[model samples]
Target: MNEEKNKGGMMSVIAALGANVLVAISKFIGFAISGSAAMLNESIHSIVDCGNEILLLVGNKQAAAKVSDKHPFGQARAKYFYSLVVAMMLFFAGGALGVMEATEKLFHPEHNVENTWLVMGILVFGLIVETVSLRVAIKEIKALNKDGLSLYRFLRESRHSEILIIFAEDSCAVLGLLIALGGTLLSHFTNNPF
Candidate 1:
């Protein structure tokens, strides 16, 4: 069971790294081309995602270390602590900053944000990458549950904060992407910068 948990953690970390890299690149290119505050927000979000993935990788590595006499339960809980910090960072740094910038844009409606088809293309690519990453994470979780651990109970009581944090980050990423897409299209069609 422990081995399976370790494998799941490793898989999740790898998936996160891949997704963050792709999303970061796509958001950066979109921001460069369009100069949209929304895209800039997404770019910053992706940067945070990249950093979080690195932290998760570190946590996973540490958690997998062999247990010593002093700590028999091992370092698995460290991954959870690390993941919690990542979640807090995303909430404050990515989501809050985006909202503040968007509010400022609302106050100054004249600030133009150029739009191009390239941004749309990049967003579509990002969606695909994120979806793939999410699927991989799901698979890892399923594998971890093969030992008769009730799925719902496991999710409810999992002490690994990294799992929760990753889920939160991915959920936020997907929601933010959808909102960005809608806002970008609305702005392009109506020429309104909101």
Candidate 2:
């Protein structure tokens, strides 16, 4: 049963990772076409998410290694360490960069965002992809959760780090996409990057 649960969690992570990579690529293209700071920030966020997912997978693999003479209790702590690294990357690469970009746009406010429709389309598509990924993670979490707890409670108390991470990442991605769409639309009508 534990193994089955682990498999489900791994599948969720894989699904989110794949979706993030594709979304990152699309966001990059949109950024190139429209030169929108929001698109650029979102692209950076998706790229960071891709890296985070890879780190999680590596951490899980390392944690699963058998105990050795040098470390009798095994390397299960690797997962925690990697989770910390992922958090830092999300802060610096995603959150910090986003703030910096938005601040720059506010100061300059001279960007002419061409291809607005393209950026909007990409944002909508990203939202759909992120929603699907979130659904997959939620489904796996529900399957593993046998205590009949509420979704919020389960997320708060769950020990499955991979699924939790994916859920959080996908949730943020969806929110970011919506924000990007709003920013793009606002900039388009206002004719200012801010």
Candidate 3:
């Protein structure tokens, strides 16, 4: 049963990583084609996603470590700690930094030199990738429920928090990407790349 649980969790992590990679590639294409600041922002966001996924995997592995004399209740809660770190990184490195630079850009302003098609393409790809991750996560959550577990109760007491962190980060990323795309289009229409 433990092995089966680990297998499913690992699969979900891999699926999330795959989606992030695909979206990252799309963002790179967006950057190469148009060089829009928003595209650059989106690219950075994807990069963070890639890195965060790795962190989540690490956290998951660590949390799964067998209990020993040195510690009890296993190392599962360590996953939450690491995932909290990831959330901090996202909040500070991804969102805060991006917002700061974007504000500066707003003040100074520049021409929209990015291709809308590229931005749109990347946005679409990101949406799809996030959707896949979300789907897999939901499936896992459902399985947990089928086993006579309440989703909320599980989250409150689960040893592995990678799933929750993955969901939160991916959802945040999707929203951020959408906002970036909207800003890009608004700039394109208003002819202000700021």
Candidate 4:
């Protein structure tokens, strides 16, 4: 049962990782072609998500390490440590950079969104990818949620950190993609990149 639970959690994470990689590449290409700041922001966000997923995997491996004389208590706490690190990265790296970029753009705004259609298309594609990733996470979590706990309570009490993080990341990614699409469309229509 433990193995099955772990495997289910891992499936969500792996699915999210795959989706993030695909969106990151597409966002980068879209940014290159369209010069859209929103696309650039999303590309950077996706890259961070990919890195966070990798760290979660590393943390899982560390948690599974056999006990030794050097530390008989085991390394299970490493998962929490990595989870905290991922949260910090989301704030400091991704969120901060986005804020700084937006401030800069506000001061010296670009004239218009170039290749608007292409940029919007890429964002829509990213939305689909993130939504799929989120659905995978939700499905896995629901299977494990045998106690019929509310999502909020489950997130608070669940010991499954990896899948929870995947769920959160994908949830945020979906929202971000929608916002980017809206901003891109507004910019294109208004002929302003602010």
Pick by lDDT: 3 or 4, better one: 4
Q: Is candidate 3 or candidate 4 better by TM-score?
A: 4
lDDT of 3 by residue, 1-194 (tens): 67655544555667788988888788777777776666676677677778888987887788779999897778866667887998788788877887788788878776545567666777777887888887887677666554566777766666556677766666676786688678767877888775
Ranking by TM-score: 4, 2, 1, 3
As for model 1, its CA RMSD to the true structure in angstroms is 2.9
The RMSD of every model to the true structure, in order and in angstroms, is: 2.9, 2.3, 3.1, 2.0
State the lDDT of candidate 4 residue by residue for 90-181, as single tens digits: 77887788788779878987675568788778878889988998999999889989999999898888888887788888898888778878
Question: In model 1, how large is the Cα lDDT of residue 40?
Answer: 73
- Candidate 4's displacement at residue 144, Å, is 1.2
Tell me the TM-score of each prediction against the true structure.
0.81, 0.87, 0.78, 0.90
* Model 2 CA deviation exceeding 4 Å by range: 31-41, 189-193
Q: Is candidate 2 or candidate 3 better by lDDT?
A: 2
Best by TM-score: 4
Clashes of each: 1, 0, 0, 0
* Residue 186 local lDDT, model 4: 84
Question: Runs in model 1 with CA error above 4 Å?
Answer: 35-41, 68-74, 147-154
In TM-score terms, candidate 2 sits at: 0.87
lDDT of 3: 0.73
Question: Can you tell me which runs of candidate 3 are displaced by over 4 Å?
Answer: 4-9, 67-74, 147-158, 189-194
- lDDT (tens digit, per residue) of candidate 2 on 83-143: 7788788777777777887788678766667788897899899899999999999889888
